[model samples]
Target: MKIIAGLGNPGKEYEHTRHNMGFDVIDELARRWHVTLWKEDMKAEIGQTLVNGEKVLLVKPLTYMNNSGEAVGAIARYYKVDLDDIYIICDDLDLPPGKTRIRKKGASGGHNGIKSLIAHLGSENFNRFRIGVGHPQDGHTVVEHVLSRPYGEDIQKIEDAKIHTADSIESALKDGVDHAMNVFNPKRKG
Candidate 1:
């Protein structure tokens, strides 16, 4: 069994915000997999499906962004899923907008959602799919930037990123994390 969790705040107002990239990707995956029903459990909206003969749970935490760990940790424990079988999707303010990076294990990079997950899960060994939203600019505060929806070309960029992220997740499921990382993660210029 594999648990794929997307972190974001829960509310109609939070939809399409930069910080809700994770939820957007989850929706994309749900669409691709034909998952139409979501049950509320473990403080999350869960859609269960079979991907390549693997039982996959697509999760959108309902605990909001900062307290996401509480729901994710409870689900992981109840499901008895190994840390390696858990995957996290979230926004990254470091990379350029629409870019993505995958990490096997690491620090949260100051992301509150990731920090909460680490605190609740008692480890940072899970896989992460980070969709870049970029940092604030033009005197915009981080909170304001993350909460606001994208505009103009950025709208297309983020839409493309969501598809790219869903493809990457499929690759990780079909192949292995190492292989998926090689295929999806951009080659860094030394």
Candidate 2:
């Protein structure tokens, strides 16, 4: 089974925050697939479904961002899922808003959630679907920017990225990462 974990802090306070983009994308995916409800697990809010005929466990870790690995590891271990079959969706500040990137394997790039997962799992080789949230303007703290919400045009970009992120995950799960990368990495004009 494939475990798709969307990393973010749980609770209403963190909802709609920039750092919670991962959760946003997964919600979009579940909506598109018509998955009606998310069942609670020990460490995650999960939904079970088939994506392109493959069994998929959609997980939103309730362990918050820094400790996300605990929940992800538990689910993955119980399901006997390999690192390659795991996909993490999270926000990226390096890329401009509305952008999405898929990588088969990579370092955490300093994302706390990804770092914790790597630490617990003891591997950096896993699929990642990164949605761009963009960096703050000059003189702003990174933490403050990521925890804050977007506005105006930025909001539109984030919404678009969320939809595209879901599409990329579906593509990667169905057709493989190479095909998904080719189809999604390039700039697409609206």
- State which candidate has the highest lDDT: 1
Q: What does the lDDT read for residue 120 in candidate 2?
A: 78
Q: Assess every candidate by TM-score.
A: 0.98, 0.94
Give the range of the ten consecutive residues with the poorest summed lDDT in model 1. Answer: 150-159
Predictions in order: lDDT? 0.93, 0.88
Worst 10 residues of 2 by lDDT: 137-146
Residue pairs whose backbone atoms clash in candidate 2: none
Model 1: how far residue 148 lies from native, Å? 0.6
lDDT for position 63 in model 2: 91
Pairs with steric clashes in candidate 1 = none
lDDT of 1 at 170: 98
Candidate 1: list runs displaced more than 4 Å.
none
